[model samples]
Target: MSKKSTEQKPEVATVALVQSAQEEEDTITIPVMDIFRQMKKYFLPWVLIAVIAAGAVFGGAMLLSNSKATPLTAMVGFTYDGIEKGLDPNGNEFDANTLKSPSIIESTLTDLGMDTKKTDAIRSAITISGVVPDDTIDELTAYKSIFESTNSVDAAQKLMDVSYYPTRFEIQFAYGNSEMNRSQAADFLNTMLSNYKTYFMRTYGYNDALGDALTAVDYTTYDYPQALDVFSSTLNSLQNYVSTLSQNDNTRFRSSETGYTFADLNESINTLRSVDYATLSSYVLGKNVTKDKASLAIYYQYRIDNLNRNLSSANEKLATIADSIKNYQKDSMVVMAGADATSSSALTQPSEAYDDLISQKTDAQSSVSSYQQQIADYQSRLDKLNSSAVASKKDQEKVETDMKTVCDKLNKLIDDVNATADDYFETASYANSYSVLVPASGSVSNAVSNAVSNMMRPLLIAEALLFVCYLVFAIVRAFIVSYRRNAIATAAVEAEERKEAAEAAEKTEETEE
Candidate 1:
């Protein structure tokens, strides 16, 4: 071999040995300046490639990190410079809720044409923003924080620009539409948002009719159909009592004795109803039916007392008549000259009465006439009023009427009691069970509580699937980077050396030739 080739051969073999040793591991050791010099050519390309790859990976990761879609958007023509502009109650104040409310959001999205299967992925990738009248610092701050945590933007270029805002609220939502092409991202978000808005509108307005019905009083009644029989019976009894009183000469008419007297009854009714007599003046005005009845009662009692006085006066007159007859018999003695009281004369004259006897008889007859006159006058008056308005007064009638009224009231009271008892039985037996221990409102809230027992399993399953996907993707990314680095190191180590060496030995070859 030539001297030059021979010298280079060992150098190649030594280079091979170094390369083989370095292949097992990656390391760098050189004079600092020489390291820079040795790597100047390769480092430029490697650095450029590394920078580009880093940028690509970072940008790709940013794009992948958030794959959410915009779920709702609404274009309400109205704008509010202040909090007073909109009165969208039912909790429409939260982020995206105002813009993507179930009302107009679904329509807007439908107009935009979004895909359905990418619901969660689009939601995760998207961000929401708004434009409102710049009336206050709050508005500015809110607008500045346009992107949400869910926004996936590794680079500035992935961000969208929003313009065309009025003083009112302008709202938008963004999602990682990675499942869709860049051109289709907006369309997908718009479609899904449309559907979401529709769902929300249906949910929120579910109780509209109930609210309206609650405000209407058309169903209220002074007396329900359930009370028809009771009212009819009450009116019938009152009418019957009035009719009976009208036929009686002793009274003009009578009202049923509901509880209180006439005046008292009316006053009690007004009190219970909490209305003034003046309001009822047009109907009854100054009339006091109760007072009139009470006065009649008094008048009858007075007549009965007067009759008793007259009877007493007549009795005294009878006694006076008896006394007068006795006095006339004693003082009316007529003394005829031959008729002086002689037993012989009285016997001989066939018991002929003397003048004294005659006078006594005359006085007796006069006293009897006076007694007859007094008795006849009294008897005539009594006969004339046998059927008159005051003959019976109210002594017996009062007791009977009072007893009947009391019985009627008791019967009515019993009916009321029975009705109440029946209602209680029906309500308690057939109505929904009541909660005695817990507050009623709390019990109602419990009934309204979510039926999570039916939905929990599916929700948990979805969560688990998402978590698994995230973990797997994360592990796969890490392993790919690590394996690629190791492979690159092995390849570099093998190709780093390009020389081989051979050895030659000759001893006595010249002498034998």
Candidate 2:
């Protein structure tokens, strides 16, 4: 071979080997920076496509949200003044749970002529909360003031903006046309209250008409008392009738017994004629409930005379017995002193006289004691009878007064029912202290506000889907670009290798030639 050819061939081989080695090394050493550099070209296009997709999704979501049907919104609150205590009562919460019970809902639907199949929908749409306290209301009002200063006047509402937490027995209806929603909300509240009242009556043992009537009397004040004053005559008549009944009944009524027999009274009266008339009159005047002044005075005189006669008779018999005993003792002493011996018959006569007088005195004293006891027993019975009569009369008067108050309240409640033309409550004699604090009615912009509020979820979902699609496209496009680059580099390396081998073979053939 010539020196020029030899030098050129070695230089070409070395150059080919270096090129092949460089290609192999480049395939193994493609850095992250290079990959990023390649992907950089697609960044703007991918972002643009993603932005377009997100915009389309957001626009569609807004259109759907605005175009969808808006349900009517109705709001109301129940006042629990008649619930005995604060909101949570024993066994009867009467809050959101009670109002939303199946029985109450069914009853309300029946009364309003709504179908049963609409129950689940109605329930889903309806929202019930507890009553906000006055303090909470004040706080909310302050917040509203602040909100008004910082935001639009239309956004600063008292109740609509507050977060619901199932706090109060406030009901919100949102399932029908405006008119139906409003009417049904009111009807549902009334029915729930009716059910609660029935339960209250049954639990408290208020089973009678009077009990029912008294329930309507406002315990908060004496409005019923003043109203009841008009029925004073009726109340008085009832008391008088009760009094008459007491007087007629033998078990209740009793009169004092005068123990004077006819004959004894006649004899005593004759004996009392000797007493001065002034004394008799004075004695009779001191008596409580003295009837027939002259006759009572004569009776008092008779009593005094009869007692004196009994005293005199008892004293005389005592004196006679004492005399007989004294005489017998004197004779016994004489005989014992050895003066003259008395016969047994003489002693017997004195002893017999003493015995007879002693027996008579005992009989007289016993008769007096028995008569005094009879008079005392009669007085005790009379006092008891009078006390019972007074108590019965007082009880009757109290009951009559209470009935008057209840009747007045019942009449007032009945008038209210009639005025309202409430057929359900027509048979009821009274109502409790419950009332509707807030009636159901939708604001002018409520429908639009609700539709807007419902659109946020769909918008977020669409954006998420668009984001995923963009990411997937970007990752897949990046991989494809990398694969194509690597394939092209490999093909270039193979072509270089083939060219170098061909050059080497031609050079060797020339050398061999």
Candidate 3:
């Protein structure tokens, strides 16, 4: 019984080993050709799924693009000949964000005949950014390295606190929220820029303060002498203005609008002062022209008193300035004229302080002289008023007529000065500081192309992922199908082998019997 059991165990072990070997041999591996064949078989379906996925992605992108409007853009540049210390031509601190101010937006809306209620939308849609150069970082780094090498605390501190503002700026307007079409939005920006330019010119380029002052006084309301004083003051202001312009090297610049140069205007101002103003003053004071006798007496007395006080002050200033000039010591320098040190020359030049003192002394003396002459004139007029009878009607009428003629001439002069000043400023370089370097422009086709370009990368990535997943699915499905078929065939062969082994065993037992 033990022997029979041992033999059966060996037979069972051999059969189990044989079945394991057959199973190992039946393990299927899909080749590249099988994968390729499976992929080809499912190629149309895969293509359809890929097409659907791509269509969905593109459709979503198109819908997203349609929902958000593309912005229209314009470039503007500022160019000024004056010092750029973060100040505009009018000496106000410059801020580029003022481009989208509520006032500007309102003005733009008004100009375009659009409803003002859309101001918020328009302002919100507008954005401004400085167009920085690509080498900005490199330049900044170099600047910092130089300063650090020098160990300059001030320079390093300045670099650390530096804030850069670009001369060029890009303005964008997303008209989707503003309910404006492309053409309308472009016009809005261009018109807004136009209005801003006008505002800039009025605020900074042209100064109407002098002109306003000249035109504001009602000369007819004043007595003859007082009117002459008014005219004198206006002429002085005009003289100062022309002098300032001439000192700025604008003397030869002729205004095409006014047909007058600064030199020509200066000449006109001098002529008015020397001829018209002088003649008017002498005639009025000489004749003792008075609208009211009591008022004239009191005015003359006031003038005399004021002139005496001014004369005293002028005399004191003159004396002090003279003493300063006399006591001032000029700086002296010794220069070697030839190669030999023995040949030396002493040069004594007036210091700036000494020169300034001399200038003050000259001005003080002129003031003193002027005050003395004015006092003398007023005292003579007072004496005439006290001694002489009241003026006749004919005399008063003649004074009135002469004053009218002088006022007319002054008015014409004022007009000419205003025109010349306006023209001069309008043509100045500062007026061209802020301009539309490139006007606002946009195209629908360009917007479409940009939208497509923005979506292209993501679209390609999605399509690539879908293709890879389908390819993996096809290859996996091929392996699974090949494995099942190999497994079924191996099972049938094992069954046949097992049947043959049993028959042989039965035949051997029968032969042994």
Candidate 4:
């Protein structure tokens, strides 16, 4: 749009000429040997020294790795069940060098010609070390439970693949070779556990004495019921004699009017019953409870019979008096009064007899009352005893049940101990009991796992040592390169000094000419 001022600006041209920078671009090349020679001239000797030192370090490491430890004979084993998959233990070695990983185990076994599909069929007992991981230890712990639950030789041979790098691989027989076949290995393990169970039962399982008491044996062979009956009869005779004596108040010369009340007779009867029952329960029952139940029963029956007989005699006397009073009429009173004291011989004798009968009747009545009270007390005790006997029977039954329960538990414990010995602990030669190489914790124990994890630390330390060596090499290489550059600079400076000296001499000669 601004065509009015068509002034052209001068353009200055700048030319850039491109040319080859290297003059000997196509010159003959030096051979690799020449380059190496040049490097040797500057750095080979020091590099060689470093290499020799490195070789010495490597040799020392190898010696330590080989001559570091003794072969430990502590027997170790592991197995697993209820896992999503099975572990194939590598039979290379068991030591503190590496961890026992299930994945590693499976991979190692797969490298072999074994198929994992048949792993579930056999029981594979793996002998391993305590340095193994918790997951691996878990398998060992499971061995005990599985062996105890369902164990056999067929079960032991189910595994088709085995990775025994960490654990010793076994199929036909164990390392010790107690059995010639896989079946025998399993059988041996199972039997050891069973024997261990018996040992445990005897060691701390049950109270033998308590069991024996509950299942008590009979002490005496006497006839219980017959003896009781005879005792009752004898007691009855004694009671009857006592009653007869009481009825003979005529011999006692007692006055007809002066007599004890029924209350007094009842108290004496009550005292007799209390004393007898107390004595029986304390002495007779205690003495016979474990020794002679038959004798105790007899004694009890006799006490009851004695009470009955005494009551009967007392009642007979009271009845006679009652009958006399009931039959007494106005005419009978007049006839009794008409009888002179010592006149008509027949009438006097009859009066005397009547007086004697009245006295005897009073005494007999008192005795009858005492006996009746005693009988009542004896009956009450019998009722109490019968109730107690019922409760005692129930207690006996409970005791027997408890004994049986304990026995069953003991048997099961024994079985478990035996299985432990057979399946896992025979090699230890321990007492036939539950013997476990109790982990810092136990199988699959956290401490054990932590210890296994510690294996990685040593590996890390080895790597660190290698890294330090690399660092030292790098530092030495840098120092070497710098020293070579300084040496070359010093040589070039000396050559320049020599050339200047020569030129100075030539100039001096030219000046002279």
**What's the lDDT for residue 422 in model 2?**
25
- State residue 47's C-alpha deviation in candidate 3, in Å: 10
Clashes of 4: 34
Candidate number achieving the greatest TM-score relative to the actual structure = 3
How does model 4 score by TM-score? 0.23
Which 10 successive residues of model 3 have the least lDDT summed? 81-90
Whole-model lDDT, model 1 = 0.39
TM-score of 1: 0.20
Worst 10 residues of 1 by lDDT: 433-442
Candidate 3 residue 511 Cα shift, in angstroms, is: 24
Candidate 2, residue 358: lDDT: 73
lDDT of 4 by residue, 1-513 (tens): 222221111111101111121332334343444444444554655556555655555555444432431111123233322111323212322232122233333433354434434222222333333334566556555554565678854434432222123332211212232222323333433333333334434333333443343234221232322222333333343334334434533333222222432233334334433453234334322222222344544555687898887777677668877787556432222223335644332222245556656787878877877777766655654554455432354443443343344334333333332333222222222223232232111122432343334434554565567656655555555556655665687568557656755775566557556
lDDT by residue (75-169, candidate 2, tens digit) is: 33433343433343333444545556666666667876777665665566667665567876786787777777888565466445663333335
RMSD to true structure for each model, in Å: 37.3, 28.9, 8.0, 34.6
Rank by lDDT (best first)? 3, 2, 4, 1
Q: Where does candidate 3 stray beyond 4 Å? A: 1-72, 97-107, 115-129, 141-163, 172-179, 249-251, 297-391, 442-513
The TM-scores, one per candidate, come to: 0.20, 0.34, 0.65, 0.23
